[model samples]
Target: MNVTVKYFASLREKLNLSEEQLTLPQGVNQGDQLKAFLCLRGPQWQKVFQETGPLQIAINQERASWQDIFSDNDEIALFPPVTGG
Candidate 1:
């Protein structure tokens, strides 16, 4: 399926990208799976998506969990947890 992946905050800086269009493999249908697939890109990816800290995901503007499935043209945003002071 094709989806738009967006990065925010530190993730955007680290990846040196704000967003991109992704044509994902059939098996990479869930949020967690997508993250794992991205982690394969290199240590930086793994650190941001898997290791560094707690991450938040939203699908088509709604909050989503790791198991959430994606659809064609879906907009997925991944970012670090928000904090306020």
Candidate 2:
């Protein structure tokens, strides 16, 4: 399936990227699976994704979790946790 992926805040800084258009291979249908697919890009990608604890996700602009499933033409946003005092 094809989808758009976005990175925000520190994740963008670390990855030096803001957005990507991807046509995923078969069997990648969930948030966690998508993340694992991205992590395969390289060590920097792995570090930015795997080392970050429970990064936030949004599916088509609505908040979602790693377990959430997504589909073609979907917009997936990933970001570090937000903390406000």
Candidate 3:
């Protein structure tokens, strides 16, 4: 399936990408696995995924869990943990 992946806050700045259309690879059918697949893109992605705390994931605008299965044309938003002073 294909999906739109969006990065927000520091993640967008750090990754140098706001969003992109992704065609999910075989065996990558869940939120967690998708993250792993993205991290495989390069060292920067690896760093982001490794250093960031628990991210807030939204599938099709609704909050989603790591195990949540994705479908075609899903809009996936990844947000960094909210922080405050």
Specify the highest-lDDT model's number: 2
Candidate 1 residue spans exceeding 4 A from truth: none
Total clashes in model 3, counting residue pairs 3 or more apart in sequence or in different chains: 0
* Stretches of model 2 off by over 4 angstroms after superposition: none
Where is the poorest 10-residue window by lDDT in model 1? Answer: 44-53
Alpha-carbon lDDT of model 1: 0.89
Give the per-residue lDDT of model 2 (tens digit) for 1-85.
Answer: 9999999998888888899999999999899999889989889888887667678999999999889899999999999888999
* lDDT comparing candidate 3 with the true structure: 0.90
What TM-score does candidate 3 get on C-alpha atoms? 0.91
Evaluate all candidate structures by whole-model CA lDDT and list the values in order.
0.89, 0.91, 0.90
> How does residue 43 of candidate 1 score in lDDT?
85
**Number of the predicted model whose TM-score against the real structure is largest:** 2
- What is the TM-score (0 to 1) of candidate 2? 0.93
| Estimated TM-score for each candidate | 0.91, 0.93, 0.91
Taking the tens digit of each residue's C-alpha lDDT, what string does model 3 give over 1-85?
8899999998898888999999987888788999999988999899998787789888999988989998989999999877799
